[model samples]
Target: MATRATARPRSIDFNAAELMVKTIKGLTMDAVQKANSGHPGMPMGCADLATVLWTEFLVHDPSDPQWFDRDRFVLSAGHGSMLLYSLLHLTGYDLPMSELQNFRQWGSKTAGHPEYGHTPGVDVTTGPLGSGFAAGVGMALAERFLAARYNKPKHRIIDHMTFGVVSDGDLMEGIAAEAASLAGHLGLGKLIYLYDDNHISIDGATDISFGEDVAKRFEAYGWHVQRIDGHDHPSIREAIASARDDERRPSLICCRTTIAKGSPNKANTSASHGAPLGADEVAATKEAMGWPADPFHVPEDLRYALGEQMPEHAQNREDWDARLIAYREAHPELAAELALLIAGELPSQTFAGFDALLEGFEVGGAIASRKASHKILSKLAANHPTLLGGSADLAGSNGVLLPDTPGQSAAHPEGRNLHFGVREHGMAGVCNGMALHGGVRPFDATFLVFSDFMRGAVRLAALMNLPVVHVLTHDSFWLGEDGPTHQPIEHAMSLRLIPNLYVIRPGDAHETLGAWRLAMERKHGPTALLLTRQNLPTLAESRAEDVARGAYVLLDPAGEGDLDGIFIATGSELALAREAALRLAEQGERIRVVSMPCWEAFAEQDAAYRESVLPPSVGRERHLAVEAGSTLGWERYADHVHGIDHFGASAPAEVLAEKFGFTVEGVIERWAQIR
Candidate 1:
């Protein structure tokens, strides 16, 4: 372990703090002005609050940005990314003054939004309004869970807080409401959010669109709510101190502020919300705040003064290092486990006997893929203590319940099962946070149809390449009797459109096991396992290992003389295609069946492997695709698609299968047309 030099505690210097705030404002205005395409108002208005929080309450070592116990600060209102960028530069993170100068530029660390892996100190990607707020809740949840599980008496290794600066837009977003309710219910006392109540939006005053009593609303949500002047340094400090002391509930400090605090003409108006303050207003703002006129210039004395606490921050990390060393000596096993988790490494024995676990499923027995997933998840969770998750009020339907685990709540911080209620959007965001928090592997479940609500967070997860699992059950119209509202027609293909998201619709119990294993092994990006609500027979030929290839030949023509055509299918339709191939074989026609459970995974395979499965020798026109959902992207592989392009009606799965031409005869007819 590395240790930073110890230093004497610095006295509270309000004068230096005020100068730091002005410098933050100057950096914000200059960076936005240089970019000519960024938000400056929010950063300007919230500088005082951010300055106090970072310099005083935030516990982080700039030298060791990945310190496990460091406090996480999320700029949830990410449009004002300059606020975070300036802080990172001043506090001596890898971000430099040049990067701030290159704000929003190509290849710069300072992006239009705060990106997690892209920036050294940024904890999570934040751009979509309430996503950061919700993810912060997840970070807090992770902290509480890990602390409860690993912290010993006099050895508090995982103690930390998740803080954020949210905007009016974030509070107005429904996702934030869902997350806020859950946070309050869980009593995540370490989660704190400073609401930038500037009362302004791009459409002008926020009252025109959002007029609710925000403080009263949070109070109703069971948070420790407070109101304060955002620009008042003393009030900001006091409010944060009070929030830190509240151990029974999450805290929300509503900070009233002007849009562009020091700008003469643009202050308190919508004009400065997103656009740069222009050269004239920049100079005027600088003059108004008694700041230097030079762009991107921070007085050397002020910079040195602001960074005086760096030694203290580094020393805090060094102290934690000592405690961790002591903790390892006292509890070697737990310390080892914590080390693996913090390093995001899985045990070597995690999958040592993986094949034996799959042997329990009878080859020809009928079972829903979702139910099979439950069995696999139960086994995996038993072996992988860090693997924990829950469904969004659909645990029964989604089969996301971990056997023998208590539901997570205020009273049960060590519980592995998280109850996300009906908040699909919030659940996804929270899962992202848990993944970003680094000690836990987070997954969430919901109906395949409800994934639409989580698209924003899901997309961000893929963009950040976070290894989060999304278990989506009731995968298609086969989830019948619930009408079109409950059916997922285009969801699988739609999710596949996301660059790094793997959408796997397992065909049977064996394939479901493969999906779970793949999800756990994948270290980057996210995976969506689409399981069935209706039971289907486990194919005798299905192999769990082959599922990793994304697609494989399930059934070839019997005593093949010449290959006639290939039948491609996924999920439940694999059985239908196999039957169709067998039926065609009986009729003296040679047909091949291909099971493609995951398009993204298969696409990742080498061209030779993909070619071996699809066999370009068999022309595209000779390929007939079978699936129960929309057939939009199947054309890439098959010329004839036997699928339901329209929404399904309320009926039994069998009845809908017949109505939608999903029978063996239907596959034969569709293959005939293509041939």
Candidate 2:
């Protein structure tokens, strides 16, 4: 039961800041005490910093939370959601006092953690440590990119900073390290983070595990570092002002403070980190702070101060709106383009040219689907100004580089191509931040096997229904000679299991284009495109439009001998299914080949459309599926599934294919035994 020194004495010149901080502390204490759940120490510890930033420095309009130029705020330590809720309520966002009273209760807007779309003023949904920290880097990157592309020398339209409060746990996570390194390397100076350097963790003391000099570490990463007293308003204000003055590097302000600022017994102890202060301690803590005894009581003076500031904040937005009108009149063409991007709308020409783009593509010979993806992405980048892309040090292998565009860095912020280095998890988190920012459509690439590292970000993107594209290549055991480590045997099926994720493994060059179209057009959720290392022959019967239906017949039995069997396949296996169907045709065992590119999309179709693709009259035993991956979930569509349940071994592509029974003769032999 370690205790911190009582809060340092201060002068009486900052009554407004003191009252605001006390109001936040009272609200957070009452909410956690009522729920009897959630972490309280963090909100109480960071309340003063939050109060100064929100009331004085933060440029936001309660009337319009979506104002494009509003400074973005993220709580990397989101376990303290009541802090954000209290600020939103005090600042007159749509959040009311009743919602704070019902905090952490079922069906309330205030959940255990802050969810982005669930709460107003919550820019990014953050619960897993380090996610919000990394995402803020993404938001800062977006701001720089947009400013370079749209803003003129005289008219700086997209100038806003991304601010976040990161805890000790956040800095400890590896994802934060990766993102911080990238942000510093790119010199994203508009990004600023306040570190809650409380020397306590849930395990008691951070000295037991985290013992690094955080300021020196961030400085080594090329960040502008500052140290400040978390409880001192003037010190915090000066630190932020100094950070803003430095324009070449991102800022990390280490704020040293107690975990529970005023608690009599639990302040600065791990006991207060999670559990609420007991009812008796809560009363005593209030008395110590010189506050009222009533729960959830917002002081009259505090409310009055906020009321006086509300109209001024709203008026700022009105002034910005007027400036925008003048800027639009001065530059109508650029203004139109900016307006379309802000609205997330594609141009009419791009929409009408979709058919021509599909029709103009030519696949004269077999090629790897990854190459096909590169071609589609290159064309998409040329046409859509908002389409931004990058890869995690696998751009050459994953084929994500767009021609005629320089890589995005400090020198060339307007470039659409991003080089995210070898940080797959960080790249995914950053992409989520870009999607949440809403001006650009962001996509990142990596080997399909590495998707495991970034699964948390992918899950969060789906939960938020972000329109992010994930291009994953080297999709199967066919990525030979790299051993089982690089081979992706179960990646596709595992990704499909995540709700609201559109998993598409296209079969050929044409289908690859179709997959990109679906990913670009999607607005409600994230999409994952799994591509191949092995070359797949294009089928003459394959059509891009059929892909939207999820599955369609690619080849039917000659003379239609009552449809004795069916072969279902996806990605490179579609070519294998065709070979198998041809072999069976010679035996008079007529078979139909169906290319199921996206199982989730197919499942979404009406029952009539689904039944048309795989008729009920066809016996379950007669339906055979061939995919070079895990057999899990195949039972929903196929009776007999030929897949690799075991890990792959080191070998050339041909040897691995023969050993795994994936060839023309091998398919014939397997079908003979099944029949």
Candidate 3:
């Protein structure tokens, strides 16, 4: 672990702290009651734990929420968003009281769940239980990597920790389990989670569905585990301090408490889990805790106590600024690179040699897009130091292996390549975390068929508009012998449905280079590159520069009297469309072939640009779409579609292509009927 400057000690007034917890609980209850919808039990139950963290241990400057070195706080149990909202409001973040009052309402920052960019203090958008837990691991991993790269002997510029509040529901999620196992294996010492082990869940007591020893489970996974009383302020502080001191393994502190801790009647029951407490119950609960009965009432003493800590919090940011200046003076070259990364800006010359790299690919020579992607990625990673990623246990197959780069591990925290094992879901979630952390661009690879395993995280990445690259190889059934189980039938179309996600299936080596360029250049939202296992012939007419237009005319009738029909294709099928057009032209049939790599990117193009590729006069009736995957959604552009609507059988690539009508002859046959 990188050495951190010791914080000045401040005396904690337990009485004032108690009042702060009461204030948080009151705000949570009032927000839920106002909305008449939300999970209130969690925030009320975890108020004490949250209070101990945000007020005492959390290293954040609310005045500058985006401070590069501030510790991250993730509420993995996002149903209790009020807990985080209250912390943000109390700690002087820009989330005002009005937003809290309008919780779960339109145009409100306080959404049903914590949204990253929507909320001021939110680090990552998390609502699907285990997604935030997994993303936190990614954030911690990024901190360790950056610390190793930028921190010098006397300068610890990248030092920070990632803390999250997880619930029993978070633990019950399979994605969380996968991420926890990896976090333990990597020995992410800077990651700490406070688990709300409240016996009750929305359905009832957790024991009804979950009975395993969570502490023992974590211990087995190589984490430092501790059990504590959730409401015991002294014990909470002690456990957090111990967690901060442990520099070998990640820590999990299980905080056992009741649901709606201070409620008079609903305190340990399922009744308080989600719905707003009735008016009588709310008053009874506030009176029982000696809190003011008025809704959303924050005591004046609590405000003064938090205000007293503002200067100290602001000083942390000031101290980091000073350290950064000193580090820049001492190490100019490294400091410049660190500054660009912190600003999320790429070097101006990042793609300086891109054209030359594309020129190296032999036109008409056959190569798998996945293999082509590896070559392009190697060049990108060499020029861009912050490009960090790996495969999900399919490094060679997915072509995500970076040459001569060490895999990230405890010993090599600065490694550019990561070995994410076989956890596809965990890999996507971690990449989302890394994107959220900034300073590093993360990419993960797996077979296209396995994208189903990563859909949850992928959706969250799209929702958060995270710039994560998902390299999906074996794009179609042409993967051969793996059978229907491994072939992606609806995966491509399914992924395209995600808003803000660019699903690009490059035609050949040149287009593959363009696909990589687009992925790196896209600063918002995620990109999924669907590559082929079978080799595709590079087209001489394919212009890498034109790829950003999404679709382009690959070939047109040589005579050009009038087009008889147009064939639209993507991925390996583009070559087939071109071949079919050539064969048809030889027989006096005028045909044009269009390469549509990414529908989303093409849709963004101006009407004039799109019209140049697929003329409105041509009409959909004269268009025949060709792809090796599902034919769904092709109707939007083509009246006739040639694609696999059924599962594939175990066979050789050539046999499968012939059987599925994916060859040049198949294209000609399909076009004849359409024309």
Provide TM-scores for the models: 0.97, 0.96, 0.99
Candidate 3 residue lDDT tens string, 1-675: 235423433445898889989998999999999999998899999999888988888889999989999999999999999999999998899999999999999999999999999889899898898999999999999999999889888887998889999999999998999899999999999999999999888889888999999999999999999999998989998898888888789999999988899999989999999999988998999899887888889888888999999998898889889999999999999999988977878876678788887888888698999999998888888888888899889999999988767989898888988899999999999989999999998999999999999999999999998889999999998999999899999999999999999999999999999998888889889999999999999889987877788999999998548788899999999999999899998899988899999999999999999999898878999999999888889998998999988998899989999988888888888887775
Assess each prediction's global lDDT (C-alpha) against the native.
Answer: 0.89, 0.87, 0.91
* Local accuracy of candidate 2 as per-residue lDDT tens digits, 260-373: 899889999999888988899899999999989999998777788788887877876786787678778888887888788777776544445556655655545687889978
Ordered from best to worst lDDT, the candidate numbers read 3, 1, 2
Choose 1 or 2, whichever is better by TM-score: 1
| Model 2 regions more than 4 Å off | 1-13, 351-364
Evaluate model 3: give its lDDT.
Answer: 0.91
Query: Candidate 1, clashing residue pairs?
Result: 465-525
lDDT of 1 at 226: 96
Best by TM-score: 3
Compare candidates 1 and 3 on TM-score and give the better one: 3
lDDT of 1: 0.89
For candidate 2, give the lDDT of residue 4. Answer: 9
